[model samples]
Target: MTYCVGLLLNEGMVLLSDTRTNAGLDNIATYRKMFTFEKPGERVIVIMTAGSLSVTQTTIARLREAIDDKDSTPDQSIMLAPTMLKVAEIIGNALASVRLDIESKMEASKVSTSASMIVAGQRRGGGMRMFLVYPEGNFIEATEDTPFLQIGEHKYGKPILDRVARMDMSLDEARKAMLLSMDSTLRSNLSVGMPLDLVIIHKDDCQISERRRIEKGDPDFSRMSEMWSEALRDGFTKIQI
Candidate 1:
C-alpha cells in the first residue's frame, strides 16, 4: 500500500518512495521506505521497499548485521558480494527465508507476511545495475528495453513511465518523470502518502549524487502537481469525442 519506483538510465539511477504505511483508515503512519548502503567511492546500493513492513525491515536488518559482522564473507555480506547479481541473490534468499519464517509464526492468525524490493546500485569499477526482487527469491534486471522497475501501488503510476521514460533519458528528466509518476499515484490512492524519499546516483560514482525528502505541501512538488492537474484538464477539454 505504498509506491516505490526506480529508473536505471544511461546517465544514472533515480529512486523514489513514499513514506506512508496504513493499517486502516485511522491508523496511518509515515515510515521511511528507502534504505541506502554505501562505502563512498567504493560502492553504493539503494533499496526501495514495498509490502509488509515486517518483512522488509527484517530483511534489511539481517543484511546490515552481515555487513557489521567481523566474520562476514562474500557469501554472507552484501557489501562484500563480488557482483551486484550476487548481492541480489543474497537479498532474495534472505527475503524469502524471513517471509517464510514470519508466515509460519503467524499461521494461527492467518495473516499474510510477504514483501518485495527493488535493488539498485553500482560498485566502484562496475557498471550500474537494477533489479526487481520478487517475493520468492527470484528477480529480473532492468534492460534497455525497459530501464525501470517499480513496486507497490504501482498500477496508478505506471502509465506515465511507459509513455515517457527511456534508457537514454537524462538524470534531470528521469527525476521529474518519477515524481510526476508518484504524483499520479498520490492523487488516486489514499494508502500512499507523503513525505517522499528521492535519491540519484551517478553512474560509476559509487556515491549518492543527490537526495531529497519531499514532505506534504512542499512548494515545488505542490506547484508541479497543480500544473499537471491543470494540464490534464486542458487536455481533456481539447479532446473531441
Candidate 2:
C-alpha cells in the first residue's frame, strides 16, 4: 500500500507521494512512486502511482519506450501527444494493457495485478489539467467542485483536503495542505512511510517550479509533523462533549 495525492489549484499543481512499499511487516522497502517528464518551457507532466509495483513500473517503462521509439507517432508517445488529454489516454491504454498482460502471466500462480495513477501537467499553449486514471483504462478529472485527487491510503488525509483546499488557494498553501495530509496518513498507517516526493508546477510555465524529497527525520518535516500533531490535540481538547 501507499499514499499519493495531487492538488490542482488556480496557481499551479502540487503533488506528493510516499516511497514505502510493504509486502509484510518484515518485508517493508522503499520505492519511488512519483515520475516526471518535462520539456521545460514546452511541457511538464507529473505522474504519481499507487498499487502493484509490477504494473506501475511496466506501464511507465512502456510509455518511455514509446517516447524513445523513432517510429512512434504523436498518438503513441506522451511527449508528442497533442494534448494532455491524449497523454492521459495513451497512459491509460498502456496501463490497462500492462495490467492485463501481467494478470495473464500470474494466472498460474493465482496472483492479481492492478494499479492506478494521477496525471497532472500543462503544455505551453494549453490549459492545465489533472486526471485520476483507474486500472481499467477509465478516468475522472479534477474540477472546481473538487480541486484534488488522491490514491492509495487516502482516507486518513482526505478530511483536511475537504475542509481546507480550494481551486483559488495559493501554491504555498496548497503545498502545506498536501504535506499535512501526508502527515495524517503517516500517523494512521504503517504501510505508508517516508521518504516523500513532492513537486509543484506553476500554471502555463510548463516546467517544475520546485521539487523536494522529505526523508525520515528531516528537520523540516519533523517540525511540521510535530506541529500538526500538537494542533490536532489542542483542537480536540478545546471541543466540548
Candidate 3:
C-alpha cells in the first residue's frame, strides 16, 4: 500500500510517489517507489510503482537488464523502443511475466503478489505520453480528456485531481497540485508515509528537468500542509450549510 500519481500536462509531466512499505504495524520500512531511466536528450522514462515490492522490483530489474543487454533489439529494450506505446507494451509484458512466475511459486502459500505502475516519459522528436500499467500487463494512456493517472491509495487524493487537472496547466501548477494531492493521502492513509519522490520533465526535454525528495517534517511541505488544512477549515466556515 502506497500512493503514486502522475500528471500529464501540455507543458510537461509531474510524477510523485511515497516511499513506505509495511508488512504489519511493526514492520514498516521506507523504500523508494520512483524509478527513472534516462538517456539525457534522446529519451527519458519514469516509473512509479505501488503494490507487491517483489513484483515491482523484479519487473524493474528485468527492464534494466534488457536495456543493458547488447543483443537486445528495439522491441526488446525500452530505451530503443521507437515510441512510448511500445515501451509501455514491453513493460506490461515484463510485469505480467514476472507476476505470473512469482504467483505460481507463491500459490500454495496463498500470499498476494499484485502490483501496478504508472509510466511516463518522452523520447526525442516525439510528444510526451503517460500510461497506467495494470497488474495484468494491460495499460490505459492518459489523454486530453483525462490528463492524470493515479495508483495505490489513490482514493484519498483523487477528488482534487478530478476537479482541477487540465491538459493546459503549467508544470508549476501541476507540481502544486501533485503535492496537495499527496498531502491529502498522507493525512488519510497510514500505509503511505514520508520521503516522497517527485520529478518533473519538461516536454521534449527527454530528461528529468527537476527532482526532489520531500522527507518527513520538511519545512516547506509541512507549512503547505498546515496552510491547506487551515484553508479547508476556513472554507468550511464560509459554507452556507
Candidate 4:
C-alpha cells in the first residue's frame, strides 16, 4: 500500500507521498512514488502514483523514453504538451497502455496489475491544473468545488483535508494541512510509512518552488506530529461528547 496526496490552491500546489511498499509483513521496500518533469520557468509537471509497483514504474519509464525519442512531437511529450490537460491525456494513455501490457502477462496468476496517479503542473502562460488518472486512462481534473486529489491509503487521511483544505490558502498553510493529513495516515496505516517526498509549486513560477524529503527521524515533522496529537486530545477533552 501507499499514500499520496495533492492540493491545488490559489497560491500554488502542494504534493506529498510516502515511500513504503509492502507486499507482506516480511516483504517491504522503499521506492519513490513521485516523479517530476520540468523545464524550469517553462513548465513543471509532478506525478504521484499508487498501486502496482511494476505498472507505475514502467509507465513513468516509458514516458521518459517518449520524451527522449527523436520523433517525439509536442503531443507525444508531457514537457512539450501545450496545456496541462493534454499532459494528463498523454500520461493517462501511457499508463493504460502499460497496464494492458502487464495485465496480459499476469493473466494466469490473476495477481492484479492495477495502478492510478495524480498529475499536476502548469505550462508557461497557462493556468495550473491537476488530474487524478485511473488505470483505464480516463481522468478527473481538480475543480474549485474539489481542489485536491489522493490515492492509496487515502481514507485515513481524508478527513483533515475535508475539514481544512481550501483553494485560497497560503502556501504555508497548505503545507501544514498536507503534513497533518499525512500524519493522520501514518498513525492509522502501517503500510504508509515515511520518509516522505514533498513538493511545492508557486503559481506562475513554472518551476518547483521547494522540494524536501522528510525522513522518519526528522525533527520538525516529529514535533508537528506530536503537537497535532496533543491538540486533538485537548480538543476531545474539551468537548462534552
Candidate 5:
C-alpha cells in the first residue's frame, strides 16, 4: 500500500506520492508511484497511483505506448487530448481495461489485482483539472467544494486537509500542506514508507513547474515532521475541556 494526495487550487496543482510497496514484512520495496506526461508548454499530466503495481504499471505503459505510437491520434494520445476531461477519460479507460485484463488471472491464483489513480493536469488554453479515477474506470472531478483528491492510506492525513486546505492557497502553501499530511500518514502506517515524489504544475503552463523527491532521513522533511509533532502536542496541551 501507499499514500498519495493531490491538491487543486486556483493557482495550480500540487501532487505527492510515496514510493513504498510492501508485499509482506520481508518483501518491502520502493517503487515510484508518480508518473508524468508533458509536452513542454503544450500540456502536462501527472498521475499518482496506489494499489496493485501490475495494474498501475500496465495502464501507464499502455498510455505511453499510445502516445509514442506513430499513428496515435488526438483521441488516442493523452498529450494531444483536446481538454483535461478527455485526458481523464483516456486514462480511466486505460486503467479499467488493464484491471479487467489482469483480474481474472490473479483471481485464479487467489490474489487481487486492483488499483486506482489520481489524474491532474492542464492543456494549453484550458484550466487545470483533477480527478480521482476509480478502479472501475469511473472518476469524480475535484471541485471548488472539494479541492483535493487522495488515494491509498489517506485516513490518517485527511483531517489537516479538511481543516486547512483552500481553493485560494498559494502553491507553496499547498506543498507544505501535502508534506504535513504525508508526515501524519508516515507516522501511523507502516505500509507507506519514505522517498516521496512531489510535483507542482502552474496553471496554464502545461508543464511541470517544479518537482521534488524526499528520501528517507532528509533533513528538511525530518525537521518539519518533528516540528509538526511538537505543534500538535502543544495544541493538545492548550485545549481545555
Candidate 6:
C-alpha cells in the first residue's frame, strides 16, 4: 500500500508521495512512487503511482523507452502527445498493457495486478490539467468542482482536502494541504511510511518550480505535524457539541 496526492490550483500544482512498499510485515522497503518528465520551457509531466509495484515499474520503464525511441509517435509517447488529455491516454494505455501482461504471467498463481496513477502536467501553450487514470485505461480529469486527485491508501487523508482545498489557494497553501494530507495518512497507516517526495510547479512555467525529499525525522515536517496535532486537539476541546 501507498499514498500519493496531487492538487491543481489557480496558481499552481502540488504533489506528494510516500516511498514505502511492503510485501509483508517483515518485508518493507522504499521505492519512489513519484516520477517526472520535462522539456523545460515546453512541457512538464509528473506521474504518481500506486498498486502492484511490478506493473507500475514496468509501465514507467516502457514509457521512458517510448520517449527515447526514434520511431515513437504522439500516440505512443507522452512527451510527444499534443495535449494533456492525450498524455493521459498514452499513460493509461501503457499502464493497462503492462498490467495485463503481468497478470497473464501470474494467472496460475491467481495473484492480482491492479494499479492506478495520478497524471498531472502542463504544455507550453495549453492549460494545466490533472487526471486519475484507472487500471483499465480509463481516466477522470480534475475540475474546479474537484481540484485534487489521490490514489492508493487515500481514505485516511481525504478529509482535510475536502475541508480546506481550493482552486484559488496559493502555492504555499497547496503545499501545506498536501503535506498535511500525507501526514494524516502516515499516522493512520503503517503501510504508508516516509521519506516523502514533493514537487511544485507554478502555473504556465512548464517546468518544476521546486522539489524536495522529506526523509523520516525531518525537522520541519515533524514541527508541522506536531502543530497540527495540537491545533486539532484544541479545536476538539472548544467544540460545544
Candidate 4 residue-wise lDDT, 55-96, digit = tens: 999999999998999889988989778889999999999999
Work out how many backbone clashes candidate 6 has.
0
How do the residues 115-168 of candidate 6 rate in per-residue lDDT, one tens digit apiece?
999999999999999999999989999999999999999999999999999999
Residue lDDT tens for model 2, 172-230? 99999999999999999999999999999998899999999998999998998899889
Candidate 6: clashing pairs of residues: none
lDDT of 2: 0.94
lDDT, each prediction: 0.94, 0.94, 0.95, 0.94, 0.93, 0.96
TM-score of each: 0.98, 0.98, 0.98, 0.98, 0.98, 0.98
> Which residues of candidate 1, in runs, are more than 4 Å off?
none
Superior by lDDT: candidate 3 or candidate 5: 3
Each candidate's number of clashing pairs is 0, 0, 0, 0, 0, 0
Residues 1-241, model 3: lDDT tens digits: 8999999998999999999998877999999999999999999999999988999999999999999999999999999999999999999999999999999999999888899999999999988999999999999999999999999999999999998899899998898888999999999999999999999999889999999999899999999899999999999999996
Candidate 2 stretches greater than 4 Å from native: none
True-vs-predicted CA distance for residue 15, candidate 2, Å: 0.3
Segments in model 6 whose C-alpha atoms lie over 4 Å from true places: none
On a 0 to 100 scale, what is the lDDT of residue 57 in model 1? 93
Q: Give every collision pair in model 4.
A: none
lDDT of 5 by residue, 55-168 (tens): 999999999999999899988899778998999999999999999999977776867787999999988888999999999989999999999899999999999999999989
